[model samples]
Target: LEDEAAYDRIASYSPYDNITAKPYPAILAMGGLSDPRVTYWEPAKWIARLRDVASAGPFLCRINMDAGHGGSSGRYKRLEEVALVQAFAIWAVERSAA
Candidate 1:
């Protein structure tokens, strides 16, 4: 964590520090409440920061209450999440065309 250059190189891929004055793309980030790999708050915070810095973007995030990294435990619940993701994609595309 103390390696400044190394951390920068790795984190360069992340929008956290890379987002410029340019308008950001409409991003739809998903998080699972029970996810051990990526806690739900990570995306929530990222969206907030994106809103703060990016010139534009209807940044959106969804946190599944009954899920882990692999997503909801039930098939029906997982399907619902999948549908939501697809819908978000469509909405973003349409919004961009407008």
Candidate 2:
């Protein structure tokens, strides 16, 4: 009985339940296929839900098929992901400005 309230409170904050009609900023939902902690499906599902609910979209999913939750294990490979994020930020800014 005590946990019921907690469950309800937590459920109230769940993204799936709280989708609003308001416009949302561009979202980059990146994940790794081998990720055990934050599985790839989470991002995929989020992107799908956002597409369905949001008024507009620039939602993107970048999944690394060979990596895990921490992303690429090497320095150079990691930079590639970083670059993608930076590029996305720039693109979003340019898009919003225009």
Candidate 3:
């Protein structure tokens, strides 16, 4: 299962539903705003869906920015992403402790 076929197979089955029913140890989602392969919107939608349906909605954090697919040329965008990652990491650690 590669490419679209794999995606189709996965989409046909709602695996996330099963996963969402359980308490998540943690959930972190990161995506590029200008990703050519998979747009940022997809993950944003996913995060919304997860939050709506997942029992552990509070554990999910999504980070995305308007930086073009890789290389990190946009200074402000990269800084924002870096900040988000740092914050999410700290949050995850603290949340797990509690």
- Candidate 1 local lDDT, 13-80, one digit each (tens): 98566766678888988898999999899999888888887877888888988789998767888798
Selected candidate, larger TM-score, 1 vs 3: 1
Ranking of all candidate structures by their TM-score, best first: 2, 1, 3
What is the TM-score of candidate 2? 0.87
Task: By lDDT, rank the candidates, best first.
Answer: 2, 1, 3
**Candidate 2, 1-98: lDDT as tens digits:** 47998989998998767878778888888999999998889889888888888966688888999899898879999998899899999988888888
Best by lDDT: 2
Q: What do the candidate models score in CA lDDT, each in turn?
A: 0.86, 0.86, 0.65
TM-score per prediction, in order, is: 0.87, 0.87, 0.60
Model 2, poorest ten-residue lDDT window? 14-23
Which one wins by lDDT: 1 or 2?
2
Error of 1 at 76 (Å): 1.1
At residue 57, what lDDT does model 2 achieve? 66
